[model samples]
Each structure stands twice: as C-alpha cells, then as structure tokens.
Target chain A: MRVSELVACTGVPLATVKYYLREGLLMPGEATSATQARYGEEHVRRLGLVKALAGAGLPIPRIRKVLQLIDHPDGSLFEVLGQAIGQLPPYLDIPADPGDYPRARAVLEKLGQIYDPRYVAVAQLERALEALEDAGIPMTEERLDAYGRHIRGIAEVDIGLMPTGSAEDAVRCAVLGTAIYEPVIAAMRRLAHQDIAQNFFQKTDEQDAS
Target chain B: MRVSELVACTGVPLATVKYYLREGLLMPGEATSATQARYGEEHVRRLGLVKALAGAGLPIPRIRKVLQLIDHPDGSLFEVLGQAIGQLPPYLDIPADPGDYPRARAVLEKLGQIYDPRYVAVAQLERALEALEDAGIPMTEERLDAYGRHIRGIAEVDIGLMPTGSAEDAVRCAVLGTAIYEPVIAAMRRLAHQDIAQNFFQKTDEQDAS
Candidate 1:
C-alpha cells in the first residue's frame, strides 16, 4: 500500500500522517521507487494504535514511549510492565527519595506486592495517599488491601483481554487496554457512588428523622 | 481571624487565596473594618478545598462548579451526585443524544443500575465502550458487570470516608475524595497488573515451555 492508501485505509488525514512519519511515530515504508514508498499491513495496525493513543489525549512523546515498549519487548516482564503503565496520564512531581512514603510501602506489603521504590505508580500512589491524608481521610492498609483486592479482580479482566499473538500484540493490548478501560472503571465507580448514596445515605436521613 | 490568619492557617499563598476570592471560589469574609475583612473557620476550610482542587489540576471553572455543588446540596440526590461527578476532570465532548450508546445502557442495565441518559459519566462510559470495541475488544455485559461489581466495592470504601458533619462537609469529602482517591485506585490497578503479569503470565509462559 502506498502512503495515500495507508491514509485512506486508516482514515488519518494526509498531513497528519506525514507529521507522524516526520516525528518517527510511523515506521518508514519500503522504498518502492525514487518518488514513492509502500506501507504494509503492519503499518496499518500500528497507525490504528497510534491513532487510539492520540485520541485518548496522550502527548506524542508518551505515545512514542508506549510504541517503544510495544516495538521492543526484550525487557524483563516486571520492567516492561512498569514502563508501559508509567505512560498513563497525570504525571506528577515526586520527591528525591521514595523512603518518604513508608505508608505506601506498608500498604503494598499488606497486599503481598513488592515494588522497587522508584516505580512510577508506587510514587504516584504515595502522593495520592498523602493528599487523602492531608484532607483528613487517612488510607488504612485494610482499606488499601480491600481496594487492591477488587482492583486485582479488574486487572484480571484487563489481562484476560490480551490477544494470544506476538509479543508486540500483547504489549499493545495491555497498554491500550489500560489507557482505554481506565475511564470505564472510573465512570463505573462514580455511578456506583451515586447509586449507593441514593440508597444508603437517603435511607439514613429518613431513619434519623423518624 | 482575618484573611492573613486564614492564609497562615492554610499555608496557601496570599495571591492565590486572593485569586480564589476574586474568582468567587471562596466565600467573601465579613467586613470588620475599612481596611480588612474577617474570615471565619468556614472560609479557612473552603480555602483548603479550593487549594486542593486547584492543585489536583482542575481548571478554575470546573473548580467553581464543584464549589457550587458543595455549597448547594438542595437538589435531588441523583441530580446533585450527577452534577458533582460531572465536575471531574478530562471532560469530553459528549454527543447530544445519549441514546447513541445502547451498549453503555446495556451494561448499566446488566449491573441493575439506571442512570438518566444525560448523565456525564454515562456519556463518558459510552465513548469508552466504543473505543474499546473499535480496538477489537468488545466489552461484554458480563465483563462490565464484573468491572462494576468490583468498582462497587471500591465505592463502598469511598463512601465510608465521608465525614459526619454538615451537608457541606459531606459534599466536600465526597468530591475531594473522588478526585484524590482516583489516582490511588488507578495506581493500585497498575501495580496489581505488574504483580499479576510477573506471577501469572510468567508462570504460564514457563508452563508452555515445559
């Protein structure tokens, strides 16, 4: 397929495709002649993933990082998983030392999960815990464990969706699934809160009035 | 206390607090003299919530909407809850007709939850489901139910942290808790993914090799 065919097949605009090519987001095509190059089926698939990530509001550089993980799966499983999820949004500023978050470590330990201090999600979780605590709602290990247990259930679903294909396919599935399914999870949680409050909180108010 | 005392108590900068005042995100203090006004404990608390929301990367307009929800809880429970979560970040351009998302409604029905079509989260979940399906990962009713069930567990924890105080305090707790605890839930999901990938996926690979 020529570049024009790639654009037509993927429905990406011509100039945008050119921008991706220029930015090295899209892999170069095989040179067919002095004036033209040909894209392949793999290029079409990669372009779709890139389009999804960009549509999900990921910056180009982060999309590049995710592509790097998909393109190269030679890293250790844990390292690759960490690097992939580190691409998720809301990047935060962390302190120099991870030791500043003993509570986060304690919570992770309670869940029987061990992580390197420098793991991006660990640092993010630590900061989230701090914010919750500062607002006078301390996150207990019991609560954290409960949240983790339920989250593990959802993670199982996430992993279940991975295609049984090449390493690149698996990486692509995991990263895109994480990025995409998260809003679903968050939205579901909010809906659940609304349902619970309506049922429980309102009932409590009536009982108190009685 | 005066505005300066409120600043000292909350540790928010004078300029930022003044900005919140000018933006009407914080309530005005009672005028005590020609030169100054007296802020009460409520102002201090409201200032803290404003600061937290702003630091959480919410824009000023969204912050104001959240503050309005906190201030006025006289709306129907469903409406208020919908409005509050509607204030959450990453607001998307939802279609005018919620009926466009029959799949989202189906999943909601599967969970035994009913939401007004116009709810923001419903529209968001609809778009998310479309994205997942477009990626060739169709979200089945069973999967959405499973996700919702686990998310309900997390929501139970979220509602548990509500302070037993004024309606204003409860709203503040719910809104801020939702905002702040989301990152914790997200990070936990990622950490769980890494742990499961390490223990489960690797073992599966070794078994295949064997």
Candidate 2:
C-alpha cells in the first residue's frame, strides 16, 4: 500500500503519518522511489497503534518507547507494561502529605495488598491527598480506603476485558484499555453524574417543585 | 501573606505563581507596594486548585475555563460540571472509525441506554471501538455493554463520594475529584492490572517458569 492508502485505511492524517515517519516514530516503509515510500501491512498496523496510544494520552516519546517495545524481538509483556507506568507524565507523581503516606500504608496493610509507597497505587493515593489537601477538600483514611476498594473493582473490570492470548496481545489490550477506555470510564462517570445530579443537588428544589 | 509566603503555603513555585498572576490565572492580592503584593487565603486556595486541575491533565485554557466557572456567581454546580465535561482537550474527542459510530449506537441500544450519538458516552464508546478495531482486537457488543453496566457502578461510587452541599461545594468536589482523583482511579487500575497480570498473562509464563 502507498502512504495515502495507509492513511485511508488507518484514518490517521497524512501530515501526522509524515510526522511519524520523519521523526522515525514510524519506521520508513519500502522505498518505491527516491522521493516516495510504499507502506505495507506493518505500517498500517503501526500507524493505527500509534494513533490509539496517542489518543490514550501517551506523549510521542512514550509512544515511541511503547512501539519500540512492541517491535523488539525480546520485549516481554511485563517490560512494555512497566514502560507504560514508568513513563507517566510528572504531574501524576505529586508528593503526598507526610500523614497520607502512613495512612495509605495502613490502608494497604488492612486490605492485605502489599504496600509500596513507590508503587502506582501509593503514588495515586499521594496525589489524591495532595489535590484534596491543596483544595481544602478533607479526605479521611476511611474515605481513602473506600476509594481503594472501589477502584480495585473498577480495575478488575478493566483487566477482565483484556484478552488472555500471547504476551504481545495481553500487553496491547492492557495498554489500549488503560489509555483509551479510561476516558470511556471518565465520560461515563460524568454522564452518570448528570443522570444523578438532580437528586443530589435539587432535593429542596424537588420539594418546591412538588 | 506575601508572595513568598504564598509559595511556601501552597507549595507552588514562585515563578509559577507569578506566571499565573500574569496570565490572570491567579488573581493578584492587594497591591501593598511597588513590586510587592499581599496574597491572602484566596490566592493560596486558587493556587492549590489550579495545581490539582493541571495534574488532572487539563490544559491551561481548560483550567482557566474551569476556574472561571467556579468563580462566576450563579455558576450552579451543574454549570461547572458541564464546563469540566465540555471543555475536554481535543485528544479525548478522538475521531471514530466510519463503522464504529453505528456499532457504538447498536451497543448502547442493546444495553437499554437511550443515549444520543452526540452524547459523550457514544463518542467514547466509538473511540473504544475504533481503537480495538484498528489494532485488530476483537470486541463484541455484549462485551461493550457489559463494560457499560460495570462502569455505571464505578460512576455510582464516584458520585456517592461527592458531598451534597450547596452548588459551589458540589462543583468544587466534582472538579477536584474529576481532576485529581482521576489519576487515583487510573493509577489504581494500573496497579490492579499488575496485580491481575500474574493470573491473566503469567499462567502460561508461570508454566514456563516451572
């Protein structure tokens, strides 16, 4: 397939395809001519995957690393997953309040899950605390633990959706579901809020209406 | 308090505080003297909220819109929540495949959710479908509807966590939770993936290990 065919099939923009090509984010296709390149199935597949990852909110550099992992002969599923977690933008790494760490530890301890402050769960707890603290939205340990328990169920749903094929397939499912489906979760929550907001906020208003 | 004191109190960098002031993101405190300002509690609070929203991956313009909604008198909690949803960065507005929109509609129809094609859920589901399709990951409508049902429960947990106070408080909680705690949700899911990856992916790998 030509570059245009790749774009048509993948639905990625022509300029973006070229950008990926120029940046070496997408490997150059077979050279049909000095000025032209002929893309094939791999290019189309890579193009779609890149678009999906970028849509998942991975930066170009991180996306590149993910693609590299996918391309490498010896890239384990675990390695690709680690890259996905480790390459998160710095904002997610908010420093927790001194008290929250111990509280998170206790929550982990009580839940029978291993506690590592450095783990993603702990980092998430820290950021949640930091944001809550900064906004003056007080969060108690009970509330935090409740969130942990609830989010674990959410995670189970996400993991359950993934295919249990080869390691490559598992990694792809994990990456896309984590990134793309996240908005699906968030968007649904917002919709759910809209669905429920009346009762929560308009109780007195409801009384007046009745 | 002074600007330096604001930095210490909010843990935001001095330069960032100045940038916010220049960008009109942070309303400056009283002008006590040339090159000096007396930032009070409002500045500190706004600074913290800004940091949290940014952490939630809202771009500056969207953050500004969110703050504007928070600040506007008569900004009902509903309006603020709407702003948070409507002003999502373009990346989340991922274009769906030609066939995926109709497929998403079918999924929603079968699930008994009478959502518009223009609705965020439909759009999100379309992207989810597109991502899966592009990568050749098989997804059945039954699977997608199953996800929707489970995700509604997740949304309930999120909404339940919200305070049923005045509109202002609701908006604040919504913004903070949607922004800051979202990472908490995402992070927990990732951590959960790691927790489950053993059983999901490593069953065969474990056999190899033995």
Q: Pick the candidate with the highest DockQ.
A: 1
lDDT per residue for candidate 2 within A84-160, as digits (tens), equals: 55554433553345354764555456666633355555666655555666666656565556656666776676677
lDDT of 1 by residue, B176-203 (tens): 7777888888888887887777777678
| Candidate 1 ranges with C-alpha deviation above 4 Å | A93-96, A201-210, B93-95, B201-210
Please count the clashing residue pairs in each candidate, in the order shown. Answer: 0, 0
Q: Kindly give the stretch of ten consecutive residues in candidate 1 chain B with the minimal lDDT sum.
A: B73-82
| Count of clashing pairs, candidate 1 | 0
Task: Tell me which residue pairs clash in candidate 1.
Answer: none
Clashing residue pairs found in predicted model 2: none
Deviation (Å) of A180 in candidate 2: 1.8
The DockQ figures for the candidates are 0.67, 0.38
Local accuracy by lDDT, each model: 0.79, 0.66
TM-score of chain A of each: 0.84, 0.78
Cand. 2 Cα-lDDT: 0.66
RMSD of each: 2.8, 5.3
